[model samples]
Target: MLKQNLSPDLTPLRHAHRLATLYSYEILDTQRESVFDDITRMASTICRTPIASITLIDAERQWFKSEIGLGKSQTPISASICAHVVLENDVLVIADTSADRRFGGNPLYTGDPDLKFYAGAPITTADGVTLGTMCVLDTVSRSLTQEQIDMLRMLARQVMMHLELRRMLRLSEKTSDYRARMLASAAHDLRQPLFVASLSVQSLLQEAAPHQLKRLTLANGGLETIKKGFNRMLIAASGHASFTLAELDDTDLGDVLEFIHANFLPLAERKDIRLSVLRTRLHVHSDAVQLETLIGNLVANAVKYTEAGGRVVVGCRRHADHVALHIIDTGIGMASESVNTLFEAFRQGDAQSEGLGLGLWIAKRTAEALGVSVQIHSVPGRGTHFILSLPLKASTEPSSEPIVQVR
Candidate 1:
């Protein structure tokens, strides 16, 4: 005997939560794939039904992720028999939709290519959320045999498994791409400084005693650059270190900015660019070392790109609930279009620019780890600004520490 229940019980809150879970899969409105199409086709053939569909119940619509002989991509949820199947979270076998009180008045049942029979197995996640159904429809009233019902249920599980697999595969591919880009950037950036240090030492050896002092100074400068490059590399590499949230401390933002100024000032001077920091008494919740690394990358990048007489400013602005740390640089600013790729590893605004272009990428990852927001604004030939918005640590009071000048 076919189970009969036209109007399935569902609560508004539960349905809304189900919709949220469905959206998280990101499967709605996507293109059809052979994996799902194969399942629907097989379901139709196995059940001896002319029509089969892999339906997804969205907010107000029944979308066909895959269909065989349905001849339609979607229909209103009100007109869908599968919507009831989602609520049941089990196989729904209606021997005759025309006789079933729940679906007899449904337009899909009375219209052309009339649907008289339906057998649906809920496509459910392991977490017990029913996304939709894998259903077979027929024009003539008929019941699915016990064996056929079991097969349909197995096929529904396959469909859900495929959806999960697809999502995992996509995530894996993205992670792999990210790792590749980071490796490429690290290799290129690390090589440049080491190469420069090697060449500086070689040139120093060839200089006469009278010019040895100048050559030695240049060699020392190259070593300093190498050390700075390694520092950036080490900070970026150590980002994956496991740390408990309990270890998070109240960080003085001003002190971190001062350290960035002191460290980058010499590099800025070498380029004949000015590096300045405007002191602020803002306190934020963050790890001091990680915060320093994040700010260091920004300051280094600013000084690296600015012209000889350009200025790079580091300051903080307090908002209602957060503090914005700004790294403003009068450098060769990037085009609006290029800004989108700035945080992508190995991507550079100017292909000829020094380093591997991973500074912003590292900075972005660090911000994410620290639970902060990073914003960027730039204009070509003018300048760029990177703002890191950090949540205020209300428990800590701001300090009246004197501003540290490194210029």
Candidate 2:
């Protein structure tokens, strides 16, 4: 390592990109961490100094993340002697401040800088952006051996690793929160459909009609989708990983559509809407529960937006290499401008909209996780259409009995 001199460039090392990179760790002004305190204590022990600190430099100040024998938690950048370490590519050492004409009366945290000694290794990022330093100082004039200097550099590296690991955990927690919110919103949307199923069950118990019993069957299937999807989401959140559907073995698209139709049938009927599915016995490789969820959300949105007398249909057609499943709704379609931002979370055509505005966004995310492509076409005052292109991988068909509610 280069032993740097006191001749600092004097230019503030406040480069915007470098500051942004340091701030990415989200460690500034946070509560004191025991791990960092331990490192500083070890540094003091190894170098036999009265003071040691782990610091971070922002634009205006150098804040001590961890320190021992330092009375102050922070000081302005101009007052910080460690601030010069950011300008050095390697460790900087001043054997005796009293010998240096400019530092004869400088104020250090120990309140005795007349003849103090300082040694600091630049706390550098993997790409070599120096944030601050891991440093030790003494009121008496002294210097560290080459071995002690190398050890100080090693401690600097350990600081960087802890910062990196902490950043990753925080980012993972944010992603898990996002996915959990999506799942909770999705779970909220299913309640109305599920409640309608309960009503249908009551009618069947009173012997109102045989079709009433079919609605109950649809509710049962939808419950399975919720159970399986919830478990998958919990697993993803716990691991701080993205929601994945690697278990796409073989799924019956017909069965998937059948569940969608059953789940939303009663909701559509209450609004005097005709909800129907055009059946196809197509087999595709996908996660069945998540596939059903994607289709279910689209179908749910279709029923929600369509007028009382309008119609929403679900169907599929074969292409050369994939199957195009369609969700067509004759309702109050959105403008082209609104269609562009439909998949962004919480974005809606009307600010006073009815639902939470997560349906289309959830649909979009689910499609991505399942490796399905979604296309939307809509025009104001007419209708909206959704197309999902599923990968072509047909296998021996799964047993899918017809639902009575499908026309």
> What number of clashing residue pairs does each candidate have, in the order they appear?
0, 0
lDDT of 1 by residue, 302-330 (tens): 88789999999888876767777778888
lDDT tens per residue, model 2, 1-407: 21323434546577888889989988898766555776787789879998999988888788999888877788777666777788766798988766665453345523444327889999988678998999998888898988688778877876775575455435544574445544455444653354335434543545546776676667656665664564454345435434444577778888988888788999999999999897778877688888987888888888888889998988887676777788888888998888888886545555545543556766776787678999999878778888899886754334343323222
RMSD of each: 20.3, 19.9
* Every candidate's lDDT: 0.73, 0.72
For candidate 2, the per-residue lDDT at 309 reads 92
For each candidate, give its TM-score against the true structure: 0.43, 0.44
